[model samples]
Target: MEIIEKAPAKINLGLDALYKRQDGYHELEMIMASVDLADRLTFELLPKNEIVIETDSSFLPVDRRNHVYQAAELLKDTFQLTQGVKIYIEKRIPVAAGLAGGSSDCAAALRGLNRLWNLGLSLAELAELGSKIGSDVPYCIHGGTAFVTGRGEKIDFLPSMPQCWVVLVKPKMSVSTSSIFGSLSFNSIQHPDIRGLKQAIEADDYLLMTEKIGNALESVTIKRHPVVQQIKDRMMKYGADAALMSGSGPTVFALCEKKTRAQRIYNGLKGFCDEVYIVRTLK
Candidate 1:
């Protein structure tokens, strides 16, 4: 049997790190939403108990360390399934771009395997399993707009965000999430108005949403990679309603009210960046 899934990239509308926990994870409050840009996953059943991964991208590891393979193993162990599976990932989303490519791929694998193996796991159960894979995996398991807290494992469903064009730019460099967290000086950080952002979204106040847009990690990322700041500046100058770095360091996204303006910004940044995508908010 073959099962296909769409693994969409995620954008953090608001992300703040409150404190580092004893478990080596940080406490965070973030608002995440899916974008139209996605990676495709195709699963094929195997005769033996093995997890195989194939991807066009030469950069990503295909071994057991790969999140997709890990997801298959987790499901097999959890359910005691005898079947093996082969996963093919069409990698459109940039690797390590802070777009949750790996996490989404893992989520896709979990969802695909459930269908392929006749495991009637609920979405909540799948998300619970996903959390064991990665913090972002749980949210990606049930893709949509959400308010995430508690090391990004806890999710609260939010109303669909107002439709808009998102211009995403990924520079030719990858930033390590661990290094960013290690470099962060929590004392100097300014907390974003996460509550205000949530209320604005609830009320459908686009203007207030744009005004309140902020990420506490921006300063930490910008200091390390000035290109991120430059991207944000250029996007704002080119008429984005709000521009912020999505997750940790590199990939920056600009929210535009109009598609044409987003296209303009995308075209303008193409020369400066290796990867640039213009996509609509999935919600």
Candidate 2:
């Protein structure tokens, strides 16, 4: 039997870092939402006892270095499954674009394997397992909109934010997430209003949501890569209702309630950036 999963890319509507924890990870509060842009994964049973990954992307590893391979390995080890499986990734999301593409693929692998093996794991259980893979995996497993806290493991499901078209612009260069975090100076941090953003989504107030959208990491990333700021400025100039960096560094997404405005942003960005996409929230 074969199972397929759609791993949608996630965008951070709002992200704030409260402080560095004793464990050396930042205590974070964020509003995360899934976008229609996604990568597709196909899982097929293998006769031998091994996990194999195949993907169109030349840069991605098929070995344990890949998140999909890691997910399959974790499940195989935990469940002591004798059967093997092959996973083929139809990559759509850009690599290392701050879009949580890898994490989403990891989540998809976990979900797909559960069905393929008849493991009968609940989403909560899968999400619990996902924590071992990456911070974004849990939220990606539950996909939609959520208020995330505690370094991104804690998820509080929220009603879908007011629907809007999302225009994403990815710079050709990828920024290192670890490097971005390392350069963060707590004293200079400008925290985004994560709670207000959450509340705005809860109230279904699109205008307020646009106003509240911000990212604490934006300035840190902008300092290193000015192109990110340039993309944001262009997005707003093209008629986006609001614009913000999705996660850490490179990809910036703009929200527009109207399709025409979104199209304008998309059209404007096409010539400016090599990678641009216009999509909607997954809800």
Candidate 3:
């Protein structure tokens, strides 16, 4: 049997670093929402007891390092399933760009394999299983606007965000999320107004949402890649309603209420950056 799933990309609308825990993991509160851009995962049952991963993009790994492979292996080991499957990923999202592309794929795998193998796992159970693979996998299991806390393992779903066109631009460089977090001086960092952002989402106040959008990790990334800040600056200069770096580094997106403004920002970014996409929020 074969099944297909869509692994959508996510962006942090508001991310704050609360404090470093005794276990060395940083306590975080993040506002995240899935975007229209996504990767497609196609699963087909295999005869032997082995997991196989295939992707056309030479940029991706097809082994256990790939989250899709890890997610499949995890399910097999936990459920003691004898069957195997071949997973083909149609890569649309950018890799290592803080888009949680791999984590979303892992979520897709857990969800798809559940139906394929007839595991009968609930969404919460699957999400708990997925959290072991990556922090973002749990959120991707149910893509929408949410308040995520405690290393991104805790999620509180929010109403769908106001409609807006997002122009995403990624430079031709990959970022290390670990290094970005590593370089952070936790003792001294600005925290985003989480309550304000939440209220804005609840009220469907677009202007307030834009005004309150912030990422604590943005400074560290902008320092490493000045082009990231430059992209934001250009977007704001080109009349984007609001612009900010998505997650860690590299990928920056601008929010606009009108398609003309989104297109203008996209066109302006073409020469400045290699990869640019103009897509609307997924409602």
Candidate 4:
């Protein structure tokens, strides 16, 4: 049997790091939502006990280090299953772009394999299992709008965000999430109003949502890569309702109230960015 799953990408509407925890992971509050942009995962049942990955992305490692493979291994060990599976990743989302591409793929594999092997694991169980793989994996397992805290493993589902077009632009450079967090000075940071953003989302007020959009790591990332700042400026100049870098990003996203405006910005940034996408906020 073969199961296919579409794993959507995520964008942080508001992200605030409270402090670096004693465990070395930073304590944070983030309001994140899924976008139409996604990676595709296909699972094929195999007679032998093995995990195989096929992908077009040259950058992604296919070995045990790959998050998708990790997911399979975790599930296999937890369920004590003797069967193996072949995993194929159709990479549409950009790699190492802070878009949670790898995490999403991992989540999708977990979901797909649950059905493929007749392992009756609940979503909560799957999420709990996913947490061991990565901070972002749990949320990716339940893709939608969410209020995430505690290094991103804890999840509180929120109402669907107001509909809007998202114009995403990824620069040629890749960013290291650890490096960005390392440079952060938690003492002097101006935290974003995550509460207000949640309220705006619950009310479905676009303007209020725009006003509350902010990312605490933006300053640190922009300093390292000026192009990130330039992209934000261009998005605002092109009339984006709000613009912010998503996660530890070189990938910047702008929320546009109008589809036409989003298309305009998408075309405008293609010259400067290596990859540009115009997609709707995932429902």
Candidate 5:
């Protein structure tokens, strides 16, 4: 039987980098949520004892370097299974745009393969395995809203964010996450109020949530790509409750409480940017 999974794009409402860790990863606390924009994965059993990955996107690597391939291999080795599978990815999310598209896809692969092989693994189990793949994998495994910490392995499920329309604009350029983080000077970078952001979400206060929205990495990215800030500026000018660069972003998203305002932002940015999307947060 073929198993299908939806891999939604993640948006960070608040992200803070406290310091560089001993492991070379920045100590982080983030409030993350998924949007309706997603990639689809379809899994079918392959007769040969091997893993195969195919995607409609010309830009993605289909081999061992791909996270989905690593996820499948990890599961197979851990479970000692001979059964093989072919995974077809319907690519919808923009790559390297700070959306966690690859991590989400890898999570979907682990979830799908679990069912196709009847591993009977719980999401927690799947997430444990997923953590081995990437920082965002664990959160993607349990998609919704979450307070993530400790280089993204620790996840605290939070209440659903106050409902809003998200208008995303992806600039023509892609960003390297490592380079962005490498450029960070923790001494000077402003830390977002992770605790306050969490409280606002828990209280379901959208206004406070927006007021607290910040990313420690925004200045680092804006130095390299001014388009990110430009988009945020345009978003605010066109009527957005809050605008922030999500993750290590070339993609900036604006949150709006009203659809009409979101549409106006979308309309204004559609002509300026090649990839623009208006989507709601996934409840």
Candidate 6:
């Protein structure tokens, strides 16, 4: 039997760092929504008791480092199951793009393996297991709009974001999240208004929502890759209502209510970025 799962990419509308905890993890409050861009995973049961992974992207490793492989191994070990599975991933989202592509793939793997192995785990259970894999994996399990807090483990469900088009532009290069967060000077930077963003989402205020789109980590990544700031500026010039660097950097997203305007921005970014996608926010 074969099982297929969709692992959608997520963009942060608002992300702020609260403080560094003794646990060594920085506290974060973020608003994120899934986009139409996604990675496809196909899982097939195997008779051999070993995990196997295959993907379209040569850049991705098929070994234990791959989250899809890790997810299968995790389930197998936790349940003491002897069954093995082969996972094939069709990569659509760019790697290390700060769009939760890998985390979503891990979440999809967990969900697929649960069914493939006849392990009837609830979504909550799967999300709990996901948190062990990565901070963003839990959010990917229940793809939609959500307010994530507490190092990305605590999730508060939110209403669907107001209808809008998203133009995601990924530069040829990728930014390391650890490098950005490691050297972050939180005291020197300004934080986004998390409360205001929450209010805008509650009221379904599209204009306010667009205005409030911000990411604290963007500055750190912008410093490393000046191209990020250039992308944001170019998106505005191309007719985006508001633009922000999603999550860390490199991948900048522009929000536009008009399809024509979004198309214009997408076309404009295509000249600058190798990977540009015009995707609708899942509402």
Best by lDDT: 5
lDDT of model 2 at residue 263? 96
Q: Tell me the number of clashing residue pairs for each predicted model.
A: 0, 0, 0, 0, 0, 0
Candidate 3 residue pairs in clash (backbone atoms < 3 Å): none
Better of 3 and 5 by lDDT: 5
In the range 1-283, model 1's lDDT, one tens digit per residue, is 6889999999998998999999999999999999999999999999988888998889879998899989988999988888888899999998888899999999999999989998999988999999998999999998888999998889999988878889999999998888888888877997899999998888888888888878888889899899999999999888888899988858999999999899989989999998999998887
lDDT of 2 by residue, 181-255 (tens): 878899999988777888899999999999999999999999989999999999999999999998896999999
Each prediction's TM-score against the native?
A: 0.98, 0.99, 0.98, 0.98, 0.99, 0.99
Query: Could you tell me which residue pairs clash in candidate 6?
Result: none
- Candidate 6 residue 127 Cα shift, in angstroms, is 0.8
Pairs in steric clash, model 1:
none
TM-score of 4: 0.98
- In order of lDDT, best first, we have 5, 2, 4, 6, 1, 3
lDDT of 6 by residue, 13-124 (tens): 9999888889877899999999999999999988999899999998899999999888998898899999889999999999999999999999999999999999999999
Model 3 TM-score, all chains together: 0.98
Model 3 ranges off by over 4 Å: none
Q: Model 5, 61-125: lDDT tens per residue?
A: 99999999999999999989999899999999999999999999999999999999989999999
Compared with the true structure, model 2 gives a TM-score of 0.99
Q: Compared with the true structure, what per-residue lDDT tens digits does model 3 show for residues 1-283?
A: 6799999998889988887789777888999988999999999999999999999888998998999999999999998899989999999998898788888999999999999999999999999998888888899998899999897789899998888999999998999887988888877677889889999999999999999999999999988899998999999999999998887867998999999999999999999888899887775
Query: Which is the winner by lDDT between candidate 4 and candidate 5?
Result: 5
Misplaced by over 4 Å in model 1 are none
Task: At residue 17, give the lDDT of candidate 3.
Answer: 84
